[model samples]
Target chain A: MMPIAITDPDDPRIEPYRAVRERDLVGRQHRFIVEGEVVLRVLLQQSRFDIESLLLAENRIDSLSNALENLPPNVPVYTANRQVMDAIVGFPIHRGILAMARRAPLPPVEDFLATLPQEALIVGLVGLANHDNVGGIFRNAAAFGAQGILLDQESCDPLYRKAVRVSVGGALIVPFTRVASANAMVRALQGASFEILAFSPAGQEILSQVKPARRTALLLGAEGPGLPPDLLAQTRTVSIPMSGGFDSLNVATTSGIALHHLKSQRS
Target chain B: MMPIAITDPDDPRIEPYRAVRERDLVGRQHRFIVEGEVVLRVLLQQSRFDIESLLLAENRIDSLSNALENLPPNVPVYTANRQVMDAIVGFPIHRGILAMARRAPLPPVEDFLATLPQEALIVGLVGLANHDNVGGIFRNAAAFGAQGILLDQESCDPLYRKAVRVSVGGALIVPFTRVASANAMVRALQGASFEILAFSPAGQEILSQVKPARRTALLLGAEGPGLPPDLLAQTRTVSIPMSGGFDSLNVATTSGIALHHLKSQRS
Candidate 1:
């Protein structure tokens, strides 16, 4: 696959790479930008997305020949020098690699839940608007072999460039879709026979005391206003048991700890 | 507890708060800058540091009256408008709070270890250069009640501004000190009668199978090039069983999981 030379930063062919920081990806529902060679490799392997095109630093093209050979020939791979690359992204792009990818419409919450195995362990995030937390949770889900992740409407898009990078490409691999609210997520999981467990600092039971059922769905909320009291009442409440009365673990870290207990400890 | 008014951004008394990002904090070994009202409140309570002074945005002063009353009379609090605050910090300073705190010299690693109780669970970090990871680990350490954290010299300063913010002021609460290298960190912990456990992907034993001793230390490395081969050989290698053979969890997340097991499982 020969690389197309992009001499001008404003080349219409590579318009997708322009001034990325200012553009809110939320409005661009079908498309997301992923940066760095590591994440780009993961994007190429996933089937849920199509690689629209790839923009690379001129010097990186020769080294990426092996990776390029595996990519579909129809995907346009554009090469730009440092100056043009910097101009397109509106900053010094570190890995000198970027890929514009298109996501297929996600299946509805009920439809997606039906695809999971009977013993599947899933993570449901509620009102987590921060991209870093969303990405980190996916990374944790991937590490522990979680079957899928469910996100509420208020959660940020996992594929946001910064979130994808922070997840270290986990966002590209872990299967995920969104639901309407935390309550809706709980109902769908229950309908699928998954035991809903809501985690919060104020919960009654310590984490180690909670026995994960055959199919468990761990629910977590944002850092400050933790899992809703009403929502928690409807599910088994488990807490990490702060030793020194420390506030709480970062949401991503919380996901990793809970997922490890359910997935690895059970195994 | 009246606030000292600073009409000019160039006031020499507020010199400590200027251009924080550009300033070489590494050279200023004894002093650290903490930002945001949440972190500033934590700094005020910790005895490990002396409050040099505080610089606040004028609009925030009246609201922080209750907190202001708790400070010692000698501590000078400066107030400036939004324009002056932005000029000093080289960006939009949120929550209009900043503190220059002076840390007393850290005790020798060995000396610090002798101060802990008979049973202590500590997290040892090696070659973790990212500030967010360092901060996140401290937050995890605090959440799980780890006795202390020992960082290799290759790691970034936990007191770094970004790290302190990400830790949500955990860096101020958790006790930590530094050593020369990963090897030294392991040796010091071992000399203090700690069961050294180095966490890595290539380890033979599964995490749940490993037994914790009366005194234990969990050693973690950077994401890509994990604990060196020699370091792993020196300690008992315990691994997290990844069912999907996925890449390892983030170092901070791993710390939270491992520390939680060591701290809570025994209880």
Candidate 2:
């Protein structure tokens, strides 16, 4: 596909890019923006989403030539100067690359679980409203080979721009879907024969000693309030032994440690 | 200490709280500001720093009464109504609590190392300038029983307000001192009989298999640049085994996993 030059920031072709900050605050009409060079590369190379279009600062085009060469023939590549790009994005275009993409409908929780490999590891999140935590957890999930992730309805969308950037494109690579509630997620995983290990400060088992089953779902909750008391009571919960009166670890950091332990020690 | 009511935003006694955003850009003299209720609790109960004073929204005083009761006798507590507090802070006082505290001189690197117990696990950071990463690493260090931390000069201050907030008071609890360079940090740890394990993607040992020495230092560098080649060469190196085409984990998350692994399996 040829690169289309966009001289005006208000051009209708680039309407989606206008006032990017305000767009992020509202919905994106079922599309998500991929920002920066790295995540754009991931989107073009391997993301499951279908590319709607690409916007690049003219100067960044040459450097991204190799990646652009592989773009799907129908995808339009739009170029703008620094000033135009800044006005369109409503911010300085430092990284100079962005992509608009859309995902297909996600599979239901039970159907998603049935499709996992016989021996699999996944992460389940509950009430994780922080985008950074959600993104970091996705990054950890990818790094440690947690093939899938399940977020309860209360969790924020992983496709939110900041979350994707923090995930370093892990959000694009990993398979994820939201379930209606934490109970529904737990029930679905258990029905699939996966052992659920809920993480909490008052957990019954120490994380290091919990021998996980062939199929394991490591569950985490928001920082304070943790996994709710009802969830804790229903699941086989485990805790990372903390010292010096600190029971807090950022939820994302906690996910990383838990993912590493369970993934590494999986039989 | 009784709470002193201040009706004026520009009251000379509350000058330190003015234009906090701009103040953060510049230095906060020799003092640091602590924000929110949880961190305030940590500061009053366990921090080594001397409390200079506190500023709270008038309505917040009743909620913080228990924590205020434990404050040192000489520390002043200033209260302002929402309008005055917002004007003074240059932003809405959503969390409604803040404290100013100052620290004594940090020990020289060698002197700091001399204080560690025989069986110690500590983290050493190099070029990690992101405040969130620094704070998250400190929180992880405290959680996994890593008693102390060493940072090369390039690392951001863990006491920076955002870092402290992200650390959830781990910054106040974990004793840390910065050194001149990564090389100097390694040398000091070695002199103190620490087995310095620099973490990198190309590291020689897989993290799970590497048995840590009684006194171990888990050395981490910034995310993209990782550890310097010479530094990696000079120290024993280890890596968490990652999967697929992904090699990135947020540096902070890396510290949490490594700290847990080494701390748990220590002889």
Candidate 3:
């Protein structure tokens, strides 16, 4: 990749990176940002997403250069003084590297199940809009051996910069796809013979009591107002038993514990 | 309670609630901003904490008047126009209510443990600087039957505004204390005949393999660089099994899963 120096914060060439801060507000714009050397390097290696541009501080270019030596020579690399780079990003950039990449096209609901391995356990998210929780869910899904994540239409973008950082790059590895609606996603999973288990604090069946199945989907919702009543009515509800005084766990944490219990039962 | 309305943000009586954004940077002066009507009401009802002042938007006063009717007449209630309230806080004020409370003193290590009921399962945090994670840990601890939280000196303040808000006011309900050192904390727990289980990705014991005890402390570290080497060595290392090709779960989520597993085993 050719390295170029940038001095101005308002340089139009870096528009894609600048747009990242407001990506959430611009709904139709599906683009998002990814930072840090580790996440950037992983994305470059994947070859699934389109690379927009790269940014690095001048003094730290050599170290990042050595790591990026294998990339195509034509990829654009922008370098700036430490002060100039910090001004543009609103924080001291770590890993001395940042990359903007185009989000890859999400697979259709049918394709999502088709790509899943046989006898896989899946964590399905419906109407969960918090980016941090989305990232947390991905991190837990990876840790507990969930095969992949399935997102309903109402869920937030997993590729959002905050979500990616929160997930610690697990968003890249935990294959995910978005469906048209929660009902449609549930119907697709049911059609594929996957048992749908909706998690609720008041669930009648204890999560630990559920028998392991060849294909299982643990459904989760956002905090406060949990799963919509219709969705809750459609799926088997399971609860993680808790002490009397306590109310409920964060949605992501609940998913992790449920995932662990479900996966451990299989073993 | 007598309702007093003063329209100025700079009023001397409202000094306790001023410039709360700087509370995080003020070391000696520890104060936390609690927002929302329900949380404020709960905190007031608990009476374990000292309320420095209360801020209410002019129109919101009547709505909360019934709830505030029981407060002691001496408590100061400051009123601000919506614009002034929003300006005082650097963000859009929510629920039209805000409370400034003095930091509560953390109980001594021995006292914290002594207060727990028999067969306690506690969550311990070390070097967890993120307030959100700290708060999430509290929420999980409360949800999964953990008796209390023990914080290493390096951990962030759980009573901080962000932590309290992220925890959904669980910080008010859960009991927690800070220790000067991880070694000293572990020694205290060991002295109390509690098992110290350090959670790390590279542990010899799978979480499922270890049975829960009557009194157990699940030790957790920050997400990226887990438990410090010395701290890890001080406790028995344990891990939740992960699928191949995945890194680790978020520290808070891991604590939730561990708490759930331990609580289930105990019951």
Shares of reference contacts reproduced by the candidates, in order, are 0.85, 0.93, 0.91
**Least accurate 10 contiguous residues by lDDT in model 2 chain A:** A241-250
What's the interface RMS deviation of candidate 2?
A: 1.2
iRMS values for every prediction: 1.2, 1.2, 1.4
Residues B1-267, candidate 2: write the lDDT tens digits. Answer: 788999988799988889988988897668899999998998988787889899998888989998888898899999988889999999997988999999657899999999999988899999999999999888888787787999889998888889999888889989999899998998899899999899998899889888888888999999899999999989888988888778588898899899888877862
User: Which window of ten consecutive residues has the lowest lDDT sum in model 2 chain B?
Assistant: B258-267
lDDT over C-alpha atoms for residue A164 of model 2: 92
Better of 2 and 3 by TM-score: 2
What lDDT tens digits, residue by residue, belong to model 3 across residues B139-227? 77766656788999899988887788777677876788999878888988998889889999988799977897788898998878888
Task: List the candidate numbers ranked by TM-score, top first.
Answer: 2, 1, 3
lDDT per residue (tens digit) for residues A146-247 in model 2: 889999989998998999999999999889998999999988988999999999988989888878798999999998878988888888999888886775
TM-score of each: 0.94, 0.97, 0.89
Q: Which ten residues in a row have the lowest lDDT in candidate 3 chain B?
A: B22-31
Tens digit per residue, CA lDDT, model 1, A1-267: 878999988899998789888765434567889888777777776435789999999888878787777799899999989999999889998789999989767789899989988888888999999988998998888778788889899988888888888877788787899998888898899898999889988887888777788889999999899888889888888888876656678889889889888775577
Models ranked on lDDT: 2, 1, 3
- In model 1, which residue pairs have backbone atoms overlapping below 3 Å? none
Which candidate number would show the highest DockQ if scored against the true structure?
Answer: 2
Candidate 3 segments exceeding 4 Å error: A1-15, A22-24, A27-31, A45-53, A65-78, A83-95, A245-247, B27-31, B45-47, B50-53, B62-78, B84-92
For each candidate, the DockQ is 0.77, 0.80, 0.70
